[model samples]
Target: MAEAYPLKFQENHKSHWARTLRNLGLAYHQIGDNTQALDYAKHALDIYARLAQDKPKRFEPDWAMSLNDYANLLSDKGDNTQALDYCKQALNIRERLAQDKSEDFESDWAMSLNNYANRLSDNGDSTQVLACAKQSLDIYARLAQDKPKRFEPDWAISLSNYAIRLSDNGDSTQALTCAKQALDIRERLAQNQPERFEPGWAMSLSNYANALSENGDNAQAIDFAKQALDIYARLAQDKPERFEPGWAASLNNYATYLSDNGDSTQALVYAKKALDIYARLAESNPKKRTADAERSQLNVAMLAWLITGAELVVSAEAAPDSALDYDRRPNRFYRHVLLAWAANDPAHAANALENAWQAWGAMSKAQQKNWENIFLLACGFAAARAALPPAFGTWQVQLTQFKTRRKAGLPQWMEEIARRKGFALV
Candidate 1:
């Protein structure tokens, strides 16, 4: 047998030191030490960067690679600000390399554009994100046009992301159009190569369902989501490790459609199944996957509880019953409002509570915390106007006296209620 030299590390080599830091970062990240991983990652990038500055021309590829590495790591760490900086730098390097070297060829350009656009979108900058996603779509579109049979799958994904971003930014109509176009492309591809392209079919079906759901066609959405779920279930069961989360996610999406159409019992069943798959995945390998996916499992469990009024048993639980680790706060508030309304006016308040609870129960945590808060507030105002008693005027007066007497110790929700009633004595 031939003798092999053992790997060795030296103190003075900056490159080796950078590599060491990166490896340590991954190790730390694996064990759920985000802070330490972030520190090590930053140190590695700093060293790589110093080397790039020392030899700018020779280190172009290294520089770009390091920037992307840092960008992705930081983005995962949720430091989107610094992640944006690194992504932009990486884009600049890639653009220069592709333009000045490869004449901006399709393969390299498309890859770079995809990463750049996604990162820009990740940080929630609409203008730049839209521009980059559009540019990438254009590139992919052109490539697919030039070689339809070869690049169709890639093009389909880009178009899907393009539509998704548009939908996120409130252009649901345009989003449906984009999604439809991608579905057309993918359908054709799947027909041409069914054996190799089954996943593409599933993706197109799921995306079409998403667009339909956004457009309020929940009937068609449910049908399409079910079709996708069936395909993904077969594909995933055949290769569990390879397709576990995708199938689980399809089940989740299908369940969401059911939940939206007032079939939350079925939704709870599917969400629970998805949560099981996600839990297994998390236990199998947490560090290698996105935390967003793990968080989503928690979301499913929370929503299941809201739909069924059943408590979810999760791995991360604490006694105070806080909403931080749960996605059921909207439903919780909706229930509180219902309790209040039952006490106030059981007839009209019944309808008010019903509508409000539906809206509140269906919201995702991200949605509830953001623009949905405004909608919730607006709905509260509308409900109050519609359901407020004639005695509310006198009630407001009483609330003013109560507030003045208890200003130093009023609970926040009580204070909000008083303000909402326009009960101001000052």
Candidate 2:
């Protein structure tokens, strides 16, 4: 442009002026000039906003994204009051686009909702966050169920987020259900998707690993996290700037698993590595970095230090015969229970709840209710069955007593399990 024009006055025609201004604005933004970035983005927004179109306000997701990015820049510059207003405006536009029948881009709509919801969630607005998360999940669920191969990764993340929200609400059982869905999706996702084709697969695997650690099976979780970290590490090695955060996150997840699975020594070692990467990242202030990025880096550093200071790693003992052995009739619901447990990282008898629920849900309405009774009993027993270490000498007597009591279609048994945290039956 400079070679052609040689002077701004020579290229001051409307189109030429707009083009030069937009390009210069982008150049300014790339150099960390938030003021100019915001100005240029707004100028572009005004142009796009003013241009009339024949169609009824169709999808303008890119505009929303631009606005959102601009808001992030403003927010970073300590103008969150203005930033919040811009985000609200962008969100309203996306919501409008999502609702318009002619511009029903479900995937884009879901992405917009998820992004805005995550921002809202981080902003300490739980009410709006969950509402938007649910809306996004509903859309993603429909898409995933219809085309699992295309959208399973997204489905997994949304379900995981939803389950976490439910757990936060103290509805652990339902949370488990959602967690299982996410884990199952991720497990399926981790297989066969070529690295070149599905880059996000590694992130899905990492989330699965985290969910597993939370569920109480950190050993298994470690394996999954290792798988993810291996992939991410390679990616980071190939492209450090783009993949550093992911690699760092994977390290943090792996360290967490080690800590949970009774290997604090190794956990601390890895945690410190993550901290080093985070510290360097904080200093550099790399391109496209957000406040959330800084917070994440700080949080990882904090968690790593806090965890390393602890001398003894705590161990969890699962109930006896509580986890259904994976062999018998491992149908979908059987997988379902395992998936549910993945939400919190606890493994039950793969056979027990999965097969039971499969039978229960398959049965007629009357049969469903009957089987539900059995499920409740099994769930209660599962809690007791897991917690009794070998030192609990009365194991046989307790198991016998619990099963017998459960056979009586008793509510007390379920209430007890709910108290212990297997399925939150209460």
Best by lDDT: 1
Off by over 4 Å in 1: 1-58, 102-107, 190-197, 286-426
lDDT of 1 by residue, 1-426 (tens): 996554222223667788888889878866656667878887887887777777766556666776777777776655567877888888887777777665344545666677777676655566776677788788778877888777778888888888877776667778889998888887787788876887888888999898787676778889989989998899898988767778988987887778667676787788888878877777766654434355455556545545554433344222323322223344444443433323345565455545545545444433443333223333444445565433233444443433333223332332343354443222
Q: For model 1, what is the alpha-carbon lDDT of residue 342?
A: 30
Per-residue lDDT tens digits for candidate 2, residues 76-138, read: 454545666777777777677667742356776677676666555434465776788788899
Query: Over all chains combined, what TM-score does candidate 1 have?
Result: 0.64
Instruction: Give the per-residue Cα lDDT of candidate 1 at 239.
Output: 85
lDDT of 2 at 102: 22
**Candidate 1 positional error at 387, Å:** 16
